[model samples]
Structure formats: structure tokens, C-alpha cells
Target: MNEHITEIVIFTALFLLVSGMGFVAARWRRADNLASLNEWGLGGRNFGSWITWFLVGGDLYTAYTFVAVPALLFGAGATGFFAVPYTVITYPLVMLVLIRLWSVSHVHGLVTPADFVRVRFGSPTLALLVAITGIVATMPYIALQLIGIEAVLKTMGVTGDLPLIIAFAILAAYTYQSGLRAPALIAFVKDILIYIVILVAVIYIPARLGGFGSIFDAADAKFAKTPAPGDGTLLNANNQLQYITLALGSAMALFLYPHSVTGVLASRSRDVIKRNMSALPAYSLLLGLIALLGYMAIAAGITPIGTDVNTVVPQLFDQMFPDWFTGVAFAAIGIGALVPAAIMSIAAANLFTRNIYKEYLRRDATDAQEARVSKLTSLVVKVGAVLCILLIDPQFSIDLQLIGGVIILQTLPSVALGLFTRWFHRVGLIAGWTAGMTAGMVLLYNIANPANNHAHFGGSAFPLSKLGFDTPMTVYAGFLALIVNLAVAALATVLARRLGSSEGVDGTSPRDYTADAGDPEVKDDLEVAGST
Candidate 1:
């Protein structure tokens, strides 16, 4: 085979192997019934610490992580390193949020956050809004994974989106058949291959480019000569606060994501969630190594050959390693995209079937029907994601995901706060969601960069200049939107309580928050009720 053909052959073989593992996953769990939503969607909720660790890690640290993080460092310099602290902080933040979510979900057997939001706040309308918001935010994200595979394809000189379409179709099929277990099983292999690829790239690429010092020095010298000042290896006073706030803000929003919550909620126990968070920080170490690939690209004089930052890692692999080894790295990223993409589709589909379809459209739907609808919906979700990759600009796909972060953040007050107390009226939560969402959209649409004449776009810091600021201060949209959300929630909460509105009974007891896996009360389903 020609070199390009050889790369394609190797990638295809590796992907097929992963898909085969996916088909075997349902059998791996020896699921009691494949036709049940619980068995299919959540893997019977029996994932222990080790399996849950890999599943959650794989679900959270995606193809986007492998490609985008390094690409950020490569393209923007120090600002790209924001991913470092964001990932470092994500575990502890999730540790706090997930323990409560696990307890409540396990207690009520709730499958999606929308399910929790609906029951906890006593509002079907709000739950539907949350469900729709989640699906919208997650769709672009699922497509972004295709960008990762497309990156590998482009590096190998493989052209056309047709191949990516075929690959994703295969992914959707197995995921539909095997459900969460499919992705969870394949995650084991994806993580292993990615770890190997990152380890080798970190060690060998630096040596080839002289060393880490040489790489950084070269990057610094290059940027110094170029007109892109302060665009090198360090964050400066101008952007330091923005970086810190964006990093922490993203960490807070990370687990609040519907798919992320779905991933954590599938675990068997509270301790399982905690242990995974503790051990999951090691992914940050891998991420640190991965981020340096950007510096290596700069040292190797690599600039993005395309607009997609997702291609940087693959291009770096093509330049730094042999053809066969490059194929391996390509496979890692391609399969990496597959694992999370599958899980995201499944999560989004579950939200639709449980929170939307069953709640509003078909209250009498059977377990078998729920399973069928979820499978069909999973297929549709993957199809829409592919259309996004085909019809929209890849750069816009990334921006849309950031907007998803903004949208998902709006639910934090309703979902996260509701887990603590129902003192906040449902009406107040809805009002807060509306206010925060409107403010976020307006601010996001108004954000612009002088570098590009594009309107209503750009992922950089939003200047507060129009709001009367001259100090070069900028803030992330997601963080700013969250502040508005909390403020509206607090204000509306006071008014609702003052007006003597009933907050409704929370079926969840105080003891539910600390219940363990084996606790009989955990599965008793004290308040198994929802929208008609």
C-alpha cells in the first residue's frame, strides 16, 4: 500500500477492533435484559470503582481534549494553557457536585439531570427546558468529535467527509445496540492507546527537537520576531485574571454538563464517584504532557495548515513520528473521539426519551418502547451531529460548544441548588433561568475581536468596555452568565418566599445524601413520580 493507504488501513483496522469491543460490551456485563432502558442506558447502574474510573475519565477527557488543548497552546501560546488549571480543578469541583447527585439519583433511580430537575423543583416546564438545552448544547459537542477524526484523516492526506460519515454511522450502530456499556468498554482501550501515544510523543518529540528548553526557547524567539507580541510561553498581567476566572469557571461548569452528570450518575456508589475524582487528576498530568505538544509544534515550525485547531495534534504526529507510529496516534485520537461521541449521543438520547418523550408525548410508554425510542433517538442525535460537521464551519462548531457551556451553566441553580434545599421556589428558578439565558445570549452575540471583522462571534475574552471599562479587563461568557443566574435566583427566591408561595415537598430525605451503595433505603424510590 501507498503511505496514505497504509495509514488508512491501520486506522480502519484499529477502529474495527474498537467497534468489535463495543459490540461485546453488552455481553461483558451479561446484562439481565438488553431491552430495558436501565440495562441499556445506564449499564444497570452497577459500575464499580475501576470501571467507573475509566468510563468517567474517557467520557470527560475526549478527542476534543487530545486535539483542542494542544491546538490551543500551538495557536495562542500561553492562553492555551488555561486547559491545565481547568482540568486540575475539575476533579475537586466534581467531587463536591457528584457525591450529592449520585446519592439523589441512586435514591430515586433518576437517569438524567432533567429528571432530577423536574422532580426536585416540581416543574415539568422547567425540566423540559433543561432537557432541550442539554440536547442542543451536546449536539455540537458530539459533532466536534468528528473534527478530531477529520484531523487525523487530513493529516494522512485523506480527503472528503464521506469517510467520517461512514465511520460515525458504524459508531452509532454499535452504540445503539450496546448502550453505555459499549462506550464504557471501548473507553478502556481508547484510554490505553491515548496514554501510550501521549507518553511516547512527550518523551521522543522533545528529544528530537533537542529538548524542552530548546523547544520553549525556539517558540519564544519565533514569537519575539513576529508581530504577535506577548503571544509566547507566559501569561501576562493583561490576561491573568481572565485566565484564572475562565479556568475556575469552566471547572465549575464541567460536571454541571448534562452528559457529564449522566456519566457520573451511572456509577454504583458514592465512594466510587469520590475515588474516581481523586484518581482522575492523573489525567491532568497526561494533559500537561499533551499540552506541550503545542510547543513542540512551534519548535518544529508547524503552523496550522487549516482553520481547525483539532488538526494540530495529528499534524504534529505526522511530522514527529514514523508513518506506522503516526497511524497509531491517529487511531488513538480517532477512537478517542468514538468513545465520548457514543456516550454523548447516548446521554442526549436518554434525556430526550426520559425527560421529553416519556414525560410529554407518551406517558404510558413501556420499558421496551423506551429502549427502542432511545436507540432511534441515539441514531438521530448522531445524524444531526454529522450534519453539523458537514454544514457548519468547524471553527463555529467549537464556538457553539462554548455556548453549550453557557447554556448548561444556567441549570446549575435549579439542579445543583435543588439538591441542597427547595427553599428556592420553582417559579424563582425558572425566572432565573430565563434572565440568565437572555443575558448570556445578548452578551455573547455582542462579543467581538478587532482581529476579525466577524460579528456575533469569537471565543476570546469578552471586553467589558461597553459597560464602562478602560483597564483592558475581559471575562469569559460562561462565568459572567453564571453570576447573573445566581443573582436572579437569589432575588426571585426572596420574592417568592415573601409572597408565600409553596416550595413543594422534596421526596428526598436528608439521609439520602450520605447513603452508600448497599443501603436498602437508597433504592426504595420514596418519590417515584413525575409529569403526566
Candidate 2:
């Protein structure tokens, strides 16, 4: 424990500094009033290119990217690196869909994707479905951030649940006080520390352990001895299908997460969205480097200290880096967790307040009331996430995120495709969402991990044979579930139209999908609330 003092001190200092920034973030770019959802939930939606870049970067490439990605690589091998290509393709996909979402959302004064769904299809029930999906999907993700922080704490000789409680309490307090601005402000510090630590580790660690070839050779040797399927330095015939589908499915699912959409919507304009999409792939490159650290860990002969493989990277830092640098690296991982966790809680809070609380609980809620409820909801969400980490296994949190992608991908037809075309009837989309979510959950439940004593809710790999296929092919449950969703949505659309089901009035015009920041319909404040 005495040996951990350096890390504890450095990590605590940085944590306090960021905590202070989180509080001060309330005034970072002060608006006239913080009483509205627009101001409290989205930082007034006026952030420029640089702030958006860091904010979105910090939101997307989370502790999952840092801790879980490398840990997956450490434990399984090549499958973990799927995050690389997934992130690579994510920007292009976002470019295609998100700009239109931003425009439509801006003109409609939408604070959540559910708001866009409500306006686009004019179905409050369907919007409620979208909102619930966002909230449920985000909860596990926020829990994963805590897992990341816990990995750091464990490495620093910290034990027990008390530290996690305190850390999340602080996180919840600042997030309630500052709202979206808290994460937006702290994202700068989080990214800087991450960039520095990752750059140093990528360059220094590889050079220290012979070279890239040696690292690959070491990982290959380690995995070759393991009897587990898909545990190898390279993909094989059996797992290759799972690899492709997982990457593709993850790319499609990434931006569908409400927090990702929140980051996109917070941009000042469509141009900012496009420019950031173009620029965000730089983090993908960084992610690729970070993934390689798994191989570096293998080459350095580092083993995880306990049953949790997520500690591989933190232990790797403690083993490889100097004491002070290990502390810095630990701080990077810890603070990295905070930025995304804050954003996700805020995003989920906005969904509940706007779509659920406002629509059902209190239709007459004023802006101040909405903001107040959202702040409290954000606190509850954070506490829920903390409880998730403490109650469930961390590995389960990671797998739940995989399930989250599956659940959220079901929203693609309503949120992403609905941005461009309104061909699918709202009822059909609702039917699709239900079918997809149910099928995905059923499939996830059936895929068990006997080794982990999990009779159900094991992992994301679902067998294709379950779909009446003869061959031994496996695929990502999310992708297969999404196909089911789209097919059902299409078939239902045809039947609904033939049966003369009402398609609901579109509350938006085509020009609304092309509006910019200064457009008359774009509501920046109460004065322009009449325009919406």
C-alpha cells in the first residue's frame, strides 16, 4: 500500500483539479438563463469547432476505448482491435446521417432523438419508446465508465466500494450543477492527458520491448497455447464472420447512442458537424495505437493481477512506466471515465425529462421545471450507474454495453433513416422497434457463458444456426437483430399502408432539414421559441 502512495497522490490531485473544473464549467460560456433544457442540456448548442471536437472525442472514445479495448485485446486477441475499424467507419456513417439530424433537430427545437421522432412521425408513444431505449442503453455505458475508474483504483491499492461512491457523488454533483457544460469543459483536460499518455506509451513501450514484430510474436505465442476459440493473434475461419459483423454492427450502433447524438446536436451548425466528422478520425488513429498496447503488454510479459482482465492496462503501466508517469497514466484513465460518464448521464436525463417527464408526467412543465427535473434525474442516473458497477461484475458491464449496441441499433429505422425519408409509418417503426428489441434480448439471454456461471446474459456472439441456417456460422446479435428490425419495419410499412393506417402528419418541412444556425426557425432562446 505504501508503494501505491505516489499514484494515489498524483491521481487524487488531478481528480480534484478536474472536479473543480467541473464545478466552474457552469460559467464557462454563461447564457442569460440556465433554466431551460436547451441551455442546461446542450451547453446552449453554440459550441464552436474546437470545443465540439474535444467534447465529441471525449464522449465517444471513452474509458471503454482506453481500458476495455486493450483489456479485450489482452484477454482475447485480435477481436478487441475491431474497435479500430469500427471507429474508422463511424465518422463516415455519422457524416451521412447526423448532419440532417442536426438540421431537423435545430429547426424543431429538439433536445433528444425522441423529440425528433415525435415531430417527424407525430407519435408521442413512439417517441416514448425511443426515449426509453436511449435511457436503458446509456445506463450500462455509464456503468462501464465506473468500471474504468475502478480498474485504476484497484491498481492504486484502493479497495472497497466507498471510493467509487465518493467519486460518483462528486461526478453527480458537478453534473447537476453545470449540466452539459461540465463535460464539455473537462473534456479538454481529459483529452490532453489521454493524448500525452497514449502517445508516450505507444512510442516508449514498443521501443522498450524490442519492436512491433516482437510484440505480435509474443501475443501470438501466448494465444496459441490457449484452447479457447477465437483466442489468437489473428482471426480464423470460424470467428471471421463474427469479427466483420461485430465491427460493422458497432459502427452502425455508435452514433445511435443518445450521448453521441447529444454531442452532434450540440454543435453550432451543420458545417461544424461535418468538419468534426472529417476531423474525428484522428482519434481512430489514436485508438489503433491504443489497441496495440495490448500486444505491448503481452511482449512485456505483464499479467493481470487478479480475475478482472480490465486491470491489464493499469497493471501494464505500473510495471512498465516510472512511478510518476504511472500516476499520470492512471489519472488519464480515471478522468477519462468522468468526461463520458457526465455526458451520458446528461443525455439520458434530457431524454427522460423531455420525452417522458414532460410528455406524460407534466405537460405544463416550464423551462425551469424541466431543467430542475433533468438535474435531479442526472443525479439519479449517476447513482444508478454506480450501483450497477458495485452490484454486477465489471465483465458483465462490458457485455451489457454490447447488448446496449444491439438495443440501440434497433432505433436506426426511427432515428437515422427517418432523418432522410419518412416512408415507414410510425406504427410500423414502433412495431419494428419492439420486434427488434425483443429478439435481441431473447438472443442475448440464450447465449450463455458457463465459465462465468452466467446461465444467460453471457455475451454478444449469437449463432447463425439459431436462425435455421445449416452451416456453423456466427454473427453479431446486433447486426442480425437490426436486419430483423428493418425487415419487419418494411413489411409492416407495406401492410399499414395497404390497411389504410394513418401515417401521422410530419411536423417538419424539407427545408427544416437544411436549416443553419441563423435561420428564423432555429430557436436559440425564448424569443425564437415562437418560431419552433
Candidate 3:
């Protein structure tokens, strides 16, 4: 136990540092009212470029990525590298959609995508469905962050669940006190530590074990001996199509997540968001390095303790590094969990208050009431996420996360495409979301994991055979569902237009898209001006 004291001390200091920042973040900009959704949930919508960059970075790349990506490489051989290409593709995809989302969100004073969906589609039921999906999807994700900290604890042979409860209590307290700013401020430290740790691991680990070539040779030799039929190399003929579809689909769905947009929407200007999207791909380079840790684990001959892929990175660190350095690495992962978990809880809480509670339960809710509801909802979200970790197994929650992606992707037709045009009709968007959601869930439910006794997976891609094809080609369940979503929307739009159905008014303007860093019109205007 003494061997692990260094790691414990370092991580404790880091957690305290984050807590200190959480207490001070409310005063960082000194707003007159921190009791409003805009102030507490959106960080005053005043984050400049540098803070946005760090916040978004830390938000997108969680400890799940830090731990799971490497663990994937260790467990699945070449399949782990899918994260690299997916991260690479994400920025370009967001560039196509996020500018428009920012414009619409800013103009409408929207806190959640579901809020935009309700206004754009003129359907509260559809919006509520989207809201529920966002909450369900986000809950497990918050819990998954705890897995990073748990990995560190397990590595130090710290048994029992008491430590996890303590860590989450700290996270919940600060998140309640500081709101989005807590996470944004904490992100600076988390990203800095992650960059340092990954750089050191990529450099020092290979040097100690051998060069990159030697490490790969060792990994290759180990895998060659085992020779699993579907493993080795980054691609295989059997699963090539599945890989591409999953990667591309994930890239498109990445920013569709409410938490993801929550970070971007908090920015001070369109330029801040655009510039961040352009520069954010640089983090992909780091992600590639992190994923290679899986290969490093193979070379180190370290088998993960259980079926929990998230634990792989920490386990590797414990085996490879000295107790002190392991502590630093553990601190990095533990801090990594806190930043995103804070933001996710806030985002989920905002969705509940703005789209659910305020919309249906209290239409006349004031800004202070909205803030109070959201604050309480955020606490509920954290508690729910904790329950997810305690009750549901990690593997199950991970599967549910894929389901979350599919569910969020259904919002794209309403949120992303709705930004550019409204010809699709409000009712059409609703129909598309419903059909797409149903198809995606059904397909995912039918996909079986052979290794796990052919049990259906929440993360599994739909086989082409189910769609009336007999080829080896496969597609992501979300992408396929999106295709159905678009088709349904297009068809419904034509029908709605032919029947002279109400198309509803968009509350944003063309000029809104062009508004940038220093525009005065970007501020709140009472009269709504827009175009078709």
C-alpha cells in the first residue's frame, strides 16, 4: 500500500486544485447574476478563444478516450486505430454544421438542441423525445468518466468502493457550485496534464521497452502466436466497411451530442467557434499517440484484469512505470474524468430545465427559476450517473453509449440541417426523427457479439443482411438510421408542401450566419427577423 502513496498524494492535490478553481470560477467574470441559465449553464457565453479551445478539448477528449483507446489497441489489435481517423474526420464535419448551429442557438437563446427542435419543428412531443434521449445517453457517459479514476485506484490496489464515492462527491459539489465554468476552468489543468502524460508515455515507455519498431515487433509476435482470425493490422477484409461506416458515422454524430454543442455554444463569438473547429483537429494527433498505448500494452505483455476495456491504460501504467510516475499518470486520468463529467452534468441539467421542466411544466418560468431548476437537475443527473455506474456494468453502459450516439444522430436533420434551410417542414423533421430512431434501435438490438455468447450489443453495427443485402458490406446503425431520417424528411416535406401544411417560421436570419467576433447585432434583440 505504501508503494502507491505517491500516486494517492499527487491525485489528491490535483483534485483539491480543481475544487479550488470550482469555488473561484463563479467570480472569474463576476456576473451580476450567477442564478441564470446563461450565466451558470453557459459560462456567461463569454469564453474567448483560448478558454474555448481548452474547454472544448477537455470536454471532447475524456478519460474514457485516454483509458479506453489504448485499452482497445491492447485488446483488439489494429481495430483500435479507428479512433485516429474518426477524430481526424470530426473537425471537418463540424466545420460544415457548427457555424450554422452557433448562429441559430445564439439568435434563439437556446440552451439545448431539443429546445431548437421544439421551436423549429413546432412539436413538443418530438422535442421531449430528443430531450429524454440526450439525458439517457449523457448519464452513462458521466459514469464512464468515473471509470478513469477507478482505473487509477485499482492500479494502486486500492480496493472497495469508498474512494470512488469520495471522488464523485467532490465532482458533484464543485459542479453544483461553479456550473459550466468549473469544468471550463478545470479543463485547462486536465488537458495540460494529459498532454504531458501522453507525451511522456509515448516517448519514455517505448524508449524503456525499445524503439517503436521493437515495440511493434513484440506486439506483432505476440499476436502472431495467438493469430485470432479477425485480428491484426488496422483493417480486415471482413470488417473494412463496418470500420469506415462506424468511423464516419461517429464523426458526424460527435458534435450532435448536446454536451458537445453546450461547449461550443458557450463561446463568445462565431469566430471563436470557427477558429476552434479549425484548430481542434490537432488534438487528433495526440489521440493517435494515445491509441498506440494499446499496442504498447501488448508489447509489455500486460493483460487487463477484466473485460473492462477502460481499465487497460491504468493497468499498463502500473506495470510499466515506477510508483511515483504512476501517481502522476493516475492524477492525469483522474483529473481528466472530472472536467468532462462536470460539463456533461451541467449540459444534461440544462436540457432538462430548458426543454423539459421549463417548457412543459413551467412556461412562465423566470431566469432565476430556470437556473434553480437546472441546478437541482444537474445534481439529479450526477446522482443518476452514479447509479448507472453502481447498478449497471461498465460494458453495458458502454453499449448504451452507442445507443446514445444513434439517438443523438436522429437530431441532426432537425438541428444541423435545420440551420441552413426550412423547406423540409416542421412535421417532416418529426417524422424523420421518429422513423430513424426506431430503425436504429431495432437494428442495433439485432446485432450479436459472437465472443460474448452471441448476445446483442448496444454498440454493434447493423449487418447489411438485415437491410436486404447479402454482401460483406456493413454500415453504422446511426448512419443507416440517418439515411432513413433524411428520406423520411424529404418525403414528408413533399407531402406537407403538397397539402399546404403550416411550415412554421424560423426565428433566425441569413445575416446571423455572417455575424462574427465583434458584431453588435449578435446580442439579444426583441423583434425576431429571419428568412426561409
Candidate 4:
């Protein structure tokens, strides 16, 4: 092993500390028995504002934001910076929708968004679609986290897949033991490390490389030498559509991920959700700062160690910082992967247990049985994610996740908008989801990245002319697919209503959407429903 001893030692020490905390997290907010889905999957639905802030922030920001965003910026220029505005606008969008979701979920004892769909539309079929989409959408995402870990491991001079296997094994063990609580506790350490590392890097790197002006100038000069259209410091007219649509589509998709909603539902109350949404934008500011590392990498004249641009940040730190500090940053990135990976696996497992296993396989499953199944399923999900990275190209996995955004965005019509108005017929929502998902996948498949040998599933950018727009404009496949989805859903709803199709019973009331914690109705309803 050609590992840098100092960096590896520090990284290992910090990682061990977090692993210890992960195991102990099972007892952090001790419950009588974590046999209940509420206790294991949702952290007993009692997280306060501070814990909720870190948990949700840690869950959403992710290793992708840390590694992939900078990597994109390094490789593709301003287009990668789309993450900044997406994250900026995400808070307001979430604040508008998530408070209501929390209220409704709390009142109904809903553990997954699929459960809410099952209750709202009273259609198990529609709920099953939502559940399956979440699991499929989340799998690539979990794989992306492993990519994050792999990047750090590679930067530390650790080769082979053994280290990756060991790290994920530790992550799986803790998540299996503590479920959401493990990530909720580890999120604190992860965020703190990230903040310190990012703050120092932002301040120190720019100063070391002359200034931000030098960094931009270096990036501009580099991109100007390249023939790629959008690979520059500023956006051109042709690429502006892509930037806008990507940012908008991403904002729409952000909260739809099962893990994002899992964080919201785990909050103690609706007020906690509101407070966290407002405060979460601080991380967006951090994200914008982090994206600049791409420019900084260019300024530092750091060549990526391999074809994987995702390693830009790690390689940059390896070159720029002291050995000990590099270790700290690597730990931040590695632990960063763990937090979201744990949450995502737990979230996906919860969906399977509630929506698939219990709803279909065993309707009479007890709370303990549900928890048991969720824990094991979480292990399976993580294993699948690891295999995704081992078997597929890392860049392909990143591209898959970008398309995964499009996949999850299909849920917005059913889940997000469904939170406000039941105007969308359940049948219509199901049709819309199907249309959007299919169109998005087809479009993604047709866009080829020949240079990377990715003939199908190459990238998320599809040309507008393909849709008969008579323009050479390229737009995000997800946004266009969403348009098709909405249009189809509206037309389908009209037809369904005219044909006298049943609109199933609404199990949720308007009051349910505004209920808060400590409300007698909310508490009593959950108590009567038992653990779900």
C-alpha cells in the first residue's frame, strides 16, 4: 500500500471515532424498544430544531455536493455551478411544501411518502408505483455515496475495493443497528468537519493562489482552450436554457427523494420543519463556496490523478493542504458519504417495509416485524449500492444520479402538489408519473457520450429538436419530461372523470394538513393506529 501514513492514520482515527458513535447512536435517544418503525425508521418523530437542522442538512447536501459538484465544476465549468442556484431555491420550495407534509404525516402516522399516497388517493397501486420509483431513484443515489467514499480512498493512496468494502460494512452495521438515529447523530460530526474544512479551504486556497480573480482567470483560460460549448467561467446563450432548467428541475426533485422527506417526517413537529427549512439555506451558502474549489483547483494547477473528475477536491487538498489537514478533509468527505448513505438505505428500506412488504406481503406484520424487515432491507440496499459502484463506471453512476433526479421529480405531481390540493385525480397522478418516468428514461438513453464509451444512459441533456421544437436548443430531460407528464395527467384526469372512473376515498382531512405536534388529534390518532 502506497498510503500516506499521516493522512491514513488521521482518517482512520476519525473514522473509528464516528463508527463508535454510530454504534452508540442506538442508545443516544434511547427508546423503550426500537421495534416500532417510528422509533427505528423515523427516530421516534421527536427530533428538535437543532438536531433536525443538522440531520436534514446532512442528508440533503450529501457527498455529491461535496465531491461531484466540484468535480463537475472542474471538468465542465459553470454548468456544474447549477447546484448553487438549485440549492438556493430549494429552501423556499421546501418551506412551502414540507411543513404541510410534516403535519399530514404526523397526523396519519405516515412513515414514508408512499404511505401518504396510499392514504390520500386510497389506491395501493398508485402507492406501489411511488414506492418503486423511490427505491429505484434512490439506489443510484446510494451508489453515488459509495463513489464519494471511493474517491477519498483513492486519494489517500489506498487501492483495491477492500477498503471500500470495509467502510461500507461498518456503515451498514451501524445503520442496521440504529437506523436513522445513527445518521442523525453522526450528522453533527460530519457537518462540523465539513464546515471547518470548507471554511479553511475557501479562505486559504484563494489566498494561496493569489486571489479569486486569478482562479477565475485560470479557469477561463483553460475552458477557452477547450472546444466544449458550456465549459467556461460564464454561461453562453445556448447553455443558459440548460442551466435554468437543470436548476429548476433539481429544485423540484430535491425534496421528492424519499430520504429528504424522511428527514422532514422525523422532525418533532411542523414548527421544527419550518425552522429547519428557513435555516437550511446556510448550507446553500456553504455549497456555493464549495463549488469555487473547482476554480481554485484550476488556479492551483492541480491535475486530477485520473479520469474521475470527482476526485478533484480530494486531489486538490492532497496537493494544497498539510498531510494532517488533508486527512481531516478526507474524513469530512468519507463521513459525508456515510451520513447520507445510512439515511438513504434506511429510507429505502422503510419504503419497502411499509409500502411493499406490509401492504402486499404481510398485511398483519407487527411493528417489531416491520422494523426487523427494514433493518435487513437496509443492508440489502447498501449492498446493492456498493455493487453499483463496483460494477459501473463512477461517471456513469453520476450521470445515472442526474437522471435519477428526473426519475424522482416524477413524484412531485403526486407527492408535493398532492400535499396542497387533491385536484389531481389519483389515476391522473399515476398516469403522469408513468409518462414522465418513461419519457425521461428514453431521452436519457438517446443522449450519447461517445468519448466516455457511454452509448446509452450517457447524460441528462437532450436536444429540444428531438421533441419537434424546431430549435437546436438543448434542455434538461427531466424538465421536458415533467411538462409531458403534467399535460398527460391533465388530459387523463378529464377523460377519467368524464368516463366515471372512481376517485377513491380521501383518508386525510384538510385539518390533518395543518395539525402540529401535541395536538390531541395527532397524538391520539397515532396512538390508536399503533406503530407503523
Model 3 ranges off by over 4 Å: 524-532
Distance from true position, residue 234, model 2, in Å? Answer: 1.7
Structure candidate 3, residue pairs in collision: 7-327, 74-294
Better of 1 and 2 by lDDT: 2
Clash counts for all predictions: 0, 0, 2, 0
After TM-score superposition, the amount by which residue 340's alpha carbon in candidate 2 deviates from its true location, in angstroms, is 0.6
> Native-vs-model 4 lDDT?
0.89
Candidate 1 weakest ten by summed lDDT: 523-532
Q: For model 3, what is the error of residue 163's alpha carbon versus the real structure, in angstroms, after optimal superposition?
A: 1.4
Candidate-wise lDDT, in order: 0.83, 0.89, 0.80, 0.89
Cα lDDT tens digits, model 3, 1-532, are 3777887888788778877888788788767767788888988888889999999999999998888888767766777687888988888778778877777667667778887777776778767877887887788888888878787787777877788888888788878877898999889888888888889999998987888898888877776777466567556776777688778878877888878989988898777887898788878999999988888887777777766656778888887878777778888889889988999999999989988887789988888888888888888888887878777776777788778878888888877787677678877878888899898888888888676564676355577877688776666788888899999989998998999998766556777655664466566422211110
Residue-level lDDT of model 2, residues 1-532, one tens digit each, is 4798988999999999999999999998898877888888889888899999999999999986798788889888988888988998889899988888899888778889999999999999999999999999999999999888888998888999999899999999999999899999999999999999999998898888988988999999999898787689888777779888999989988888999999988889888988998899999998989888888888888878777777889989999899899999999989999999999999999999999999999998888899999999999999889888888867777777878889999999999999999999998999899899988988898887765677787777787787788866678888878988999999999999999999898999999988888888777655533232
Candidate 1 per-residue C-alpha lDDT over 1-532 given as tens digits, one digit per residue, 9 for 90 to 100: 4567767778889999998898888798676577766778888777888888888889888998888888878876888899889999888878777788888777777889888887787788888988988898899889889988888888888889889999998899899889999988999999999899999999999999999999999878876776754367898777787798889877877887777887887787788888888898888899889999988988988767656566777888888888788888899999999989998998899999999999999999987888899999999999999999899877788779878888888888888777787777887888888988888887788887544456776664777776788877778877788788888888998998999987866667778777777788666221222211
The TM-score measured for candidate 1 stands at: 0.96
Poorly placed runs, candidate 4 (over 4 Å): 1-3, 524-531
Q: Candidate 4, residues 1-532: lDDT per residue as tens digits?
A: 5558899999999999999999999998798888888888988888999999999999998987798888788888889899999998888898898888888888878989899999999999999999999998999999988888888888888889989989999999999999899999999999999999999999999998999988999999999998877578888777789899999999989889999999998888778888877899999999999999988998888787768777889989999999999999999999999999999999999999999999999999998899999999999999998888888867767777878898888988888888988888888998998899899888888887765788887777787887789876778889988998998888888888999899999999999988887887687434723844
Clash pairs, candidate 1, are: none
Report how far off residue 112 is in candidate 4 (Å): 0.5
